[model samples]
Target chain A: MKVRWRVLGGEWQETDTEAKTVGELMASLGLSAEEYLPSIGGKLVTEDEELKEGTEVTFIPVVSGG
Target chain B: MVSCSVCGKPAIYSAKYEGKAYCGEHFLEWFDRRVRKTIRKYRMFGSKEHIVVAVSGGKDSLAALHYVKKLSKRVPGWTVEALLIDEGIRGYRDVTVKDFKRCAEEWGVPYRIVSFKEEIGATLDDIVKKGAEAGLPYQPCTYCGVFRRYLLNKAAREMGATVLVTGHNLDDEVQTFMMNIMRHDVERLARLGPVTGISGQEGFVRRVKIFYEVPEKEVVVYSVLNGFFPEFVECPYARLGFRWDLRHYINLLEEKYPGTKYMILKSLLDIAEAVRKGKGGTPKRCTVCGEPSTKDVCRACELKALLGIG
Candidate 1:
């Protein structure tokens, strides 16, 4: 399974792993999804969301944005 | 020695009337009373026009509205209008706007909200997303400042406000000055005053600063001592890049040169008097709204166009 991580509105990079959950994937990348809100399939996914093949994860930084 | 939270000047010989400590120039009672006095002293309000204050639901803004409204009853000709600009941050904007509404209702001032969604068709979050999408050279503070200013003026115009008041106190002023100077934009550096109303200017609303003289540390102490505002240090995006750097640098400068912020602003005020006396920044008419603009299309319209709105 290809686990991928990306910054929202940014480039996505592929991870060479069969990570079973978002938690595992984040741990692989040495990050916490709390601070960097990760989303999958247009809905925000928590750390418990089990990863499938080609799971596209996005690390959305805490944004005040304006 | 208690250090001034604003200019970083130490209060070597001072008294604490509670947890609020004050130097001679910054005594909390004197600061509060004088700020309340300057509003009346200058007669900045009118009988017919609404005294609309732009609030960010922050500690400073809440205090500003409280004082302004407190004085409005005493002043007679004045009434308070609380204006909150919703920048369209997801949970953040919702929280602040709700707080503003609740506070206004409690205080009995007419409250109105102008959201970025309706006004600009896009939120600050959208702008940030798009910038990240484009990998663009954009500053978050730039977008925030531009959007906030444009919306505040638009809201003021819509509300038919005579004078628009903001929660900018001494520290905010000094930080702005330091930022302008860092960018070598001396013109804005010279324009820091309580009232930023360009005289003889049509279509431009006057920006009166009631906190022109109040210090930021004093504002904080006053807010805390008075239970006027919620001191939430939990802005998610506050710790982001650049502006944080600028803030830290300003604090460092204030530490190195005590009273640097106030001294710089005091001198800038003198310069503002002269610059304001002379024809100021190029004020042209916006082709879209006919309001005062530096360009044919004002920032609001330009932003709307950029975001495919309005």
Candidate 2:
């Protein structure tokens, strides 16, 4: 299945992945679940959330800098 | 869906550290209770204190301001205001400042802005440029951190704030603790706590971190749920510091092993308390600026001399 993901303020890019859930997707991307809050369709979601084909996920970086 | 620990509603947050999940309503209640517990445990403030929230127009600080403002409405004689330090970063600080103003007005909290250009005679852009031109070893964060701290303290004092509040959460604290340990800077570790700085000291406003025990992830959730999350903006110079890399590694550990961050924080507090117990000497006044300092010239003044700015 293909899922769309992007960091906030960045362009969304689609990736074909075998990952079944948000936690798996984050693991595949080498992103820490603690650092990014995944949102689907403008609502925040937990890692157990299943990913569907063409689901757009915006990963909001929770950590602020400086 | 995970059920809320309290009421079995669909869980909105799962706090792995505590082995509990909270639905939207319960999460807010839990988060607020934690905030209150932290404040009470630390004795952070009296009932009648004036709070100056040092906001950077980011999610963390803005969230801190929002909660504090919400809290002060019920506490008689408590007043809440915001103070922002504009480091004058070309693209970042400008955008965040707009968000700050909008939120302040909407929340009915009075706010003041201090800029590096006005206070230090140069914007952060200029400071970075000059540092590069002079072959200075200092990174952008160093200059920004020193000046921001100097201004926040000075501005908060001028505003008659009895206490200054910051939005620093668990992740920031643990990262700093590890950094200090790696650098062998144990004395700085002594300063980390829920309420920091030398209390009852002249020229120093006590700094309180209400979210000292809250995780950054929870902070983001709190802000979003409360409808006050600021527009996300990354500091342009954030990647230049050791902290950037360190933060990622720490978060990775936290992701793999739940409660890693909390364990680190516990270690930090214990170490800090031990260090505090052994400390007794008073801080000296900066010769040039008269701010509380350990050296004759404070870091801010030292930077000013290096940049030839006021």
Candidate 3:
């Protein structure tokens, strides 16, 4: 499957990976659930949510302050 | 393909708390409308009031400033300006100050900066060093928070602003509520709301959190989509604070059960309302700075005396 991951204020890249779940994909990228909020196709997806081909995922940091 | 919950278009953000997906156009619309709703619901400011937006060069404040600036254009007689406080963190704050000034210039908002060194005769670095040497019981954030609030309010009032708008989003509010609960600080919790500070109080300007209902992730996405996303930098001192631990724990809960942040905030509001009704006391002026205070000496004044700063 091809997953496009965009990190806010950072970079966007496409990768072809065999990961089947959102959690697996995040683990492959060395990302943690505690730090980043992940959404697939504009809807927040859980770690167990199955990833489909050509899904666009965005990662946003969970912490912000003024 | 998922569609926007409001309109039939490619959705760009899924607001889990609201259980709604929004396309770029609709998302911005939804976000702005919700902000307006918060303002109206809280009666934060009048249409003709001057608003001082506290910008930290972070995503949250920048977005708040941008949105308020945009809203000011439509609201007749409204004026918006930006204020930045330089806490004097050597490596961290200097960079964010530059980002803040650049954005303020780009947005054409009149801006002013106040610093700890100029206002208090000591930089935060000096305070931390002296605090460590003096063996102060509190962390650096304790001093920073008290002084920042003091400076922000003073500067806003000096600018003749009736309302001081901050970028505290839902995540920050919830974490603070939880922290207060854990510490059993009822007075501090009572003061938490979308808007705070009593009107007609001397030396007190109303402070409103425009993004109180909005989540942190949504603020980032809004900042990113609107071309306001600056590089993210966490305060070096923040890592050592209890709030940091609370933030991580809250985020974990939010991930497992979406809308947990909002639920916490809702409960806090209810409790805060009850506390406010039960408590009736006027704010006293700080003896040192003449600012509104709950105690004989304000927190800022207390910290300054501890640091031996003028």
Candidate 4:
């Protein structure tokens, strides 16, 4: 299935992959290991969870804390 | 003919450092080394983490951000993120908005912009309005200092930034130091230093001033030689007139005495230590925001209420 992934400040891109898990989608996106699990719409979605066709993810970089 | 005093070579002796003479090569080398040493001595950004730069879209911030990007890439263990706060200065914010947006794109650091109007109830202009209502010609910079800090701190915490770096340099510090001297604000001087961390605040990030020790001229040279400023206009409300006078006064003192910044910092450190030693009470939690504060409300909250915010 084709899933849509959009990056903030960048245009959305679609990818074709056979992988059903969020972890697999992330692997396809070229995310490095150091990147933390991001909270999508306020909940942290882990690698094992399955991603749907139209799910949106927000990657909050872990920097800038007071 | 005697050797020049500045770079110690044969050149026409001129009046910069008391009729000093030096070759062009020595002069450039001396200036370069001074910039490097000051950068290192102040420990501007720690080598281990990605640096989050706070730019106001002004010359000082733009220069600082650009230089840090160049220097960090050359030195390992250095990464950068650029953050800008649009204080909504009439034409100024709009003028620099596009450039600031493009700056991070040019440098390739994931950038975030938080507007003053969006995050807080008022832009800097609004703060001055409320402040002016009290019949005080209080500095816009003072309100800007407070608002900018709160915005940055909240944004930093939200992003989990390790180091919050600013563009404050020697001249600003020297001017502030002179202000402290005029007011005899020994405690304030002490609390102000290269790196500052408010006490008893668990989530408070450490603030570092990389250019804290560098002279104002070096920063100006770094900017002019490089010629890129996202925006260049004094704040519309910089009507205090005193701060500008203070700046000139410090420059005059610096002409007669170099290293005045170091002297002021030295005095500040002494007072900071004294304040740390039994000078402050256990800071109570602010009733409003629950952040650590000795008083019922934090300065941010107080100012927020002044604007009729919750």
Best by lDDT: 2
Task: Report clashes for each candidate as comma-separated counts.
Answer: 1, 0, 0, 20
Interface RMSD (C-alpha) of each candidate? Answer: 17.9, 1.4, 4.8, 25.0
Q: For residues B9-78, could you state the per-residue lDDT of candidate 2 as single tens digits?
A: 7677889988998887999999999999999999988989999999988998999999999999889889
**lDDT of the structure predicted as candidate 1:** 0.66
Best first by lDDT, ranked: 2, 3, 1, 4
Off by over 4 Å in 3: A1-17, A21-24, A27-58
| lDDT: worst 10-residue window of model 4 chain B | B10-19
Model 3 clashing residue pairs (backbone):
none
For each candidate in the order shown, give its overall lDDT on alpha carbons: 0.66, 0.89, 0.83, 0.62
Give stretches of model 2 more than 4 Å off: B279-281
TM-score of each: 0.70, 0.96, 0.89, 0.69
lDDT per residue, candidate 4, B1-310, as tens digits?
Answer: 3354665555321224344543445544554576567667866556687678888666567667887787787779877787888876776677666766666677776777888788776787776787778665457777676678777867876676777778777667666766866887665555577776564376566677777766554454345345553333445655563556676555556545655556766666676677657544455666877665545786778877766643
* DockQ-superior candidate, 1 or 2: 2
Worst 10 residues of 1 chain B by lDDT: B12-21
Mind giving the per-residue lDDT tens digits that candidate 2 earns over A1-66?
A: 999999888999999999999889998998888889888887777787889899899888888855
- DockQ (0 to 1) for model 3: 0.30
Task: State the DockQ of every prediction.
Answer: 0.02, 0.68, 0.30, 0.01
Rank by TM-score, descending?
2, 3, 1, 4
TM-score evaluated only on chain B, model 3: 0.96
lDDT of 3 by residue, A1-66 (tens): 898888656788999999987778888997766567677655555555668888888877757532
| Per-residue lDDT over B1-310 for candidate 3, one digit per residue giving the tens place of the 0 to 100 score | 4578888776666666667787777888888888889989988888689999998888889999999998888888899999999989987888788888888999899999999999988988889999999899888888888888899999999999989999998888998899989998888888889987655788898999999998887787688678767766778888888998888888778767988888899899999999988763568998877888888788898888887887
Q: Candidate 4 overall Cα lDDT vs. reference?
A: 0.62
Model 1, chain A: how large is the TM-score?
0.80
The parts of candidate 1 lying over 4 Å away from their true place are: A1-66, B1-28, B40-43, B46-48, B197-199, B231-233, B273-279, B307-309
Across all candidates, the chain A TM-score values are 0.80, 0.96, 0.84, 0.63
User: Under the 3 Å rule for N, CA and C atoms, how many clashes does model 3 have?
Assistant: 0
